[model samples]
Target: MRIFDPHIHMTSRTTDDYAAMAAHGVRALVEPAFWLGQPRTSVGSFVDYFDSLVGWEPFRASQFGIRHHCTIALNPKEANDPRCREVLDILPRYLAKDGVVAVGEVGYDSMTPEEDDVFAAQLELAERFELPVLVHTPHRDKAKGTTRTLEVVRESGLDPSMVVVDHLNELTVGEVADSGCWRGFSIYPDTKMDPDRMVAILTEYGTERVLVNSAADWGKSDPLRTYATGQAMLAAGFSADDVDQVLWRNPVAFYGQSGRLELEGADADEGATFEGNSILRGARAS
Candidate 1:
């Protein structure tokens, strides 16, 4: 089951996770900009993080033969911080770069007034850049968060087809489905949707505009959940074509709207370096 994980956080993962994901048939992924486990104190902190997303992380993923792409945004969780607000200003520079497939992880976190303002600003940036968006619904009060999310998307006047409302469940998927936007589910190990539940969702929704991801981050998340979901689909009698649609084709179709997705197989040149640095630890002996 070839896979393209539409959302994940490799910044917080290890190289072992990359090797495991590649072995499990994960060929490509998109790592959205999101809050670190702790608060980021300055705009410079975000600058470093975003640079790694566009630079170091892709190099790391390539070592394991996984094509890595990313989204650029001031995530909603940090929108309330006056210090981090400057991140929005610097986003345009990153948005113009290669490997930035969308403007993402942008939506309500606390649903605060500050979040509303930042979310709207990023959505406008998406319009200006003509890029796809990855909207992250609130983990708390998700149904209400998703409702307001779709409303904001409508108000932005960006084509709903260019937006993906992520972290949805059975309760919220239907509304996004009807909104003409793509639907995204993050399959987790213990919380949120799991493989079986995702299978059931696919069974009902028919896999047309669905994007399944692990969304694995610096928490108790599993990086291999995308692969697990594909296995579950097969166990539940989904055809190889059906699994491919959800795991590969759907993500390519959604993020492909950016006209920037580089789906080429990962070719790791061990001698290749980013900024005069390599993932290698010691010199090789002949």
Candidate 2:
């Protein structure tokens, strides 16, 4: 039952989250750069965020026996701010860091021109670095946004194989699949697809080129929604292997291209601590 959560925001989660995910068989995770719960006011903020993704975060996950990797990008929601361009300029540096698996969480929110600029720029960064791109389709008006996201990928001249269009639902899953890129679903508690609906999508698409994530972040989303989706698949009579492939194999195959994932031996301790620091420091051992 080894699993990989291909999209999570560990920077917004707790150390207990890492332990819980590992206890539930999440052997690895990939956290994409995202808009902070509060807006970032400076480029230094983005730098610290990127450092946490590759540095303290991975060290923390190891304590829970979960391998950690990440996607680095400017989130679409933040792209509109004129200040955001400064952060975008620095993405190439972060994308090249160890444990950065892709350029992502990048795509449209309001379909604004700024979103396009950031999205397109990151796509070029992905290409420039020969990395994969993880896209965050708009939460609202997903059907329109998903198509537009595909179009942007086409216009950027990036390989479709190096793109993953995430946060999809039934409305856009077909188009996303037909576009010859990986399709990702975020099984959230309220805003995104529920477990029952996620199971139906897998049944409809047969899981060949699809992926599922929690998209867990500062929102009221469950960090283990992907695991819950697997339970739903079991209740629906899907074979264990079928469930495993969609939830784990596809994401690993996708992110492993970045050359960052690592495994923890069974004997690994996964529990260590640092002095004078809390989860706020994000550097606690294991």
Candidate 3:
């Protein structure tokens, strides 16, 4: 089953994870810009981080035969900080860079007024850039957050088709589905929707613009959940084409709006060295 993980944090993941993803049929992914576990102190730090997302992460994923793309944004959690607000100014420059397929992970973290301001600005950025958005709904009070999120998106006047409201669950999926925006579910080991639950959603929703992702990051998340979700769907008697629509086609249709989604995911040359240093187990250092 070919997979395209539409939301994940490869910045916090390792090459071994990339290798495993490729081996398990993950052909492409989008790593949305997000807050680090700790606070970022300055705009320059986000600059450096965005550089790595479009630079180093893509290179690393290529070594393992997976296509890598990313979204650029200030991220919601840090938008409340006065210091990191300067990141909003620098986002356009990175958004123009190749492999930045969307402007994302850019919705309510705490639902502060400040977060609201930044989220609105980034929605405009998505409009200006003609890119799809990956919105992060607040984990707490998610139902309320989701309602407000739909309001914000509707007010932005960006086509709802170009926005993907992510991290949804049974409680919130109905509203997101009804909103004309794409629906996203994060399959996690715990604390989020699991594969079985995802299958249940498919059984209920019937998969039009629904998407599933692992959303694996530095936390205790599994990078293979997208693959596992596909597996569970098959076990639940969903056909291969149905699985294809949810796990692969939906993401392609969403991110493909960028007109920059060059899907050479399985076409990477297999080499295991970076910066003239060998990464292979027994290669002589040259």
- Could you give candidate 2's per-residue lDDT for residues 57-149 as a string of tens digits? 989988876778888888899888887679977887887787888988899999998888778788888888889889988878888888898
Error of 2 at 162 (Å): 1.1
Model 1 lDDT on a 0 to 1 scale: 0.89
The lDDT values for all models are: 0.89, 0.81, 0.87
Which residue segments of model 1 deviate by more than 4 Å? 266-286
Pairs that collide, model 2: 63-270, 63-286, 272-285
Give the Å shift of residue 189 in candidate 3: 0.3
Query: Count of backbone clashes for each model?
Result: 0, 3, 0
Model 3, 1-286: lDDT tens digits are: 6678999899898788887786666778999999889899998899899999999999998877578999999888899999999888888898898899999889997899999999999999999988889999999989999999999999999999999999999999999888899999999999789999999999999989988999998889999899889889999999978887888888989999899897853423224233333232221221
In model 3, what are the clashing residue pairs, if there are any?
none
State the lDDT of candidate 1 residue by residue for 109-139, as single tens digits. Answer: 9899999999999999999999999999999
Relative to the true structure, candidate 2 has a C-alpha RMSD (angstroms) of 6.0
Scored against the true structure, residue 115 in model 3 reaches a CA lDDT of 93
How many clashing pairs in candidate 1? 0
Q: What lDDT is reached at residue 11 by model 1?
A: 96
- For model 3, the local distance difference test gives 0.87
Query: Model 1, residue 176: displacement in angstroms?
Result: 0.8
